[model samples]
Target chain A: MNRKVTPAALALAFSTAVTLAASPALAAGDKDKGDKEKCYGVALAGKNDCKAGPGTTCSGSSNRDYQGNAWKYVPKGTCKEIPSPTSPTGKGQLQPFQEKG
Target chain B: MRGGGAGAGLSERLRGAGGLTVEERWAVALLDPEAPTPPDLTSWNGSDPGQRFAVYRNNVVVSLVESLAQTFPVTCELVGEEFFRAMGREFVRARPPRSTLLARYGEGFAEFVDGFPPAASVPYLADMARLEMHCLAALHAADADPAAPQVLEAALREPECLPALRLRLHPSLRCLRSEFAVFSLWDAHRGELEISQVNPLAAECGWILRSGLEVRLLPMCAGDCDFVEALARGNSFGEAAEAAAGDREFDLGRCLATLLRWGMVTSVNGIK
Candidate 1:
């Protein structure tokens, strides 16, 4: 039972698809539940969500293992759980941390 | 490494150690109004290298000022053109770009505006610069496919499980909280919608998120902003909810639904 898509519905679907398919990598999303997060000092280099800091000419150009300024979208609970070798305390921090390495 | 090391050693001997590297002297010469070109300008083919360097200086200053104008169009519009260029000249002199990327060069420009005594009359100028610069950053940030609405719905349907699962935000999502109306100020500065009207005194909270082709500077409240920041920091649903709780009525369900519809959420978990 396939009816022809109305222009309204067609446009809606097209827009939705376009919206979803835009940027293929990096960055964090936010909604009210407070469940989602962008944790800094946790992203792997070249895999940072965004904000790689000064001297980084490109989006994902994190220099070290866990550059403090680079962020990754992680679950809120997982932020502290994830281990950062360079972190001052060797643990994830809420704010950007000065890395050892 | 060999070529770079050799070049550095020669440059040091030519320009003297701890004085100014060849490139540093060139940059300094570019800013100087005097037409006397540094000996480092030997690469230039012109007979009058000093004159040529002056021409190059003018070109560099123009280009840098133009880039600043583009990055902070509103600030340019707010301050007269002559005045803006003067300010741009100072900014260039003080904080030259360390990297080749022009887009990311002016990260400190907003802070510069905040401390600028000339712009003291318009204190919100700094926040406006911050917003505009953020908009630029959002444009270049990595993108992501938001989680399907159904996935979010399913998570919401099970309130208990929601606390355990992590949500990922879209790569282009950027949030700003300011003591000034950033969005409307940005709106007023747009070329097509040039309606120069906004309240400078009122505090504002805003989020910049990109859809398919469009980037939105949407107004949000502090409560919701806190909620989003918490989540972005890797807070769990329950923890975020508690942190987001305040005098304001934070409709978690509706807000989450809007974010899903807008394609701001990347996934229900790290699976994405």
Candidate 2:
């Protein structure tokens, strides 16, 4: 309850940090590399980077109808390794991630 | 394009469409396949209006599911595509977009995943989705020039004024705290680490900041997370420092240094 950060501590922190603050920002030339280094692919499938309007709901593309709930699919991702308490063995298990009817 | 009588009659019927207009009915039907096609609607060639309506319905559902996939690719990857698509379909149908700004769509997908019964097995999936959402938001956030070193130097001159100083971080900077090792999990997906190396149950703090066009996800210590949160909430430098100082691992100088090194400090104010 009696936490207090003294001005001396603040001054010391700022003084040490000032050197890093003095460094220059990244130059314009890095923009290309920056663009390339983005974590996710810039051109994701059917994604236009928020530029285009919402996908046309009325488009007449005749795709096969996908019916039924996602219950048939189980937890098949990287989370398979994550420990789950629900597993009877008390180890990571590939549990069916759906509510059975 | 249809004959005047049929089209006009359809319009008249739509006008008195028992509380819901034809367009609204169709819009609703687009998301729900079980919903019947609007009455008296006909395709150009008259080749079964239901078939034509089904195509549009498919596009609406698939495109929205695709958008959710793109927005939460990691979450999608975690559950794999097939399951992600199915789950996304459920999310799309349950929470249809009310805004045309597709960029902001799927903002609630994280919360949706959290409560989704199917995803109960993967508890961290929601947090991962939330992290991905923050990354998307950071990528599109407004740009700001980082505060220069002179600002810190000016403030440093008056040591007593230091406690009251408030810092303004870049708009794109975001912090996340999770009971799971969400940062390590995400980093492993980036190929920076192996899945075997991560213990998902371990708690972790993460920071996302856009330096130039790149959105960087960096691991943070518990102390640094508290420090950033306090400062973000408009707590004075002293208050934030005190909050972090409680943790023995915290180093005020290093945290400040890293903030500047990443060009995250946009402005320094509250000094006389």
Candidate 3:
């Protein structure tokens, strides 16, 4: 009267357990929500704490909290800051903090 | 018909090949490490070799010196423009760029500064260069997803059972403990504030981390620095804390909170 599970069934059970164990209560997509959207500091130009989004310009003076820190959210119309012409931003657009050479 | 003179055909083919001899390679590198090929004398066909060579030399020296200036901005500022350029020329002669990435071009500078006669008086200069190099390395490290507080809490619950809880450090986190307050020297040159209040002679532990795109420096206690080093080596949180708490000044709660806020903790594992 002993019942044994097949290897396939056991693997399925194990995988389900692993998935459940690894999955957080919050949705997977929401992991970076806090970091992706919330603006932590104001821009150096005294503009709005530029919303955390793609193409944001950040620098040492961008915001006190974010100063000397990397990865500030650039709001729309704001250009990315390039340390040098050789910087990854390429050459077309002017970075917010760069002086024209 | 008029151009195929003695050795002229051989020279033309060699020039077209554009490869330099060992001596020529060294000479070109000595002039400009970034230049892909040695200058072809044939291109100047009857032009003034002196003028062309001068222009080429100037371009090479200017670009190399500029790269050094960018790499060590604070050092250049401290030494002044003219002296820094002179020093840069020396450095270029000694160690040319081995890679195209200028950010990585000055790895040996701190060591060079140690032996550099003119910079001998500024004993802190080498240490400052080391700190700057660490900052650069931290900025370019690969990104990682930080671990959540709940995972850490869970691991802490079974500290004894947790088999070496692996904590992943942020890619852009770096720590440098030096006998001189090199961080202050960097800050002074940054021109952020007037009346700099840093003691260049004092020993300090400086940590750099990339929050978003900016690199922030944090001065840490010796115990905290040791704790970070331990964690970086893949020690469990409990083990690292134990080592850290060896120093009476280590405050576990505050350290954990600071790391969390900085996004320095990338991942935590060992929780079942």
Q: Candidate 1 — which residues are off by over 4 angstroms?
A: A1-101, B1-12, B34-36, B43-46, B191-197, B247-249, B270-272
lDDT of 2 by residue, B219-242 (tens): 888788889988899998889998
Residues B1-272 of candidate 3 have per-residue lDDT tens digits of 12434755665544433465545653664465465444444443787654665677777778888767766777777778898898888888788777887656788888988889999888888887787777777766787766765766565556444435566789788788889887777777776544358778899886788765556788777767877888888886556766666667655555655666666778877667
Error of 2 at B221 (Å): 1.8
Which candidate number has the best DockQ?
2
**Candidate 3 clashes between residue pairs 3 or more apart in a chain or in different chains:** A56-A74, A68-B215, A69-B214, A70-B212, A70-B213, A70-B214, A71-B212, A71-B213, B146-B266, B147-B266
lDDT of 1 by residue, A1-101 (tens): 11232334323332343344333331223433367566778866544666787765355567555788887766677887878877887777778777775
Q: Fnat for model 1? A: 0.00
| Model 2, residue B111: C-alpha shift (Å) | 0.9
Answer with 1 or 2, whichever has the higher TM-score.
2
Q: Which 10-residue span in candidate 2 chain B carries the lowest summed lDDT?
A: B1-10
* Residue A37 lDDT, candidate 1, scale 0-100: 67
Worst 10 contiguous positions by lDDT, candidate 3 chain A: A61-70
Q: How many angstroms is residue B18 displaced in model 3 relative to the true structure, after the best TM-score fit? A: 20
lDDT (Cα, tens digit) per residue for candidate 1, span B76-167: 88787998899888888778788999767777989888878998988788888888788778777786876765665455445446455576
Residue B99 lDDT (model 3): 85
TM-score of chain B of 1: 0.86
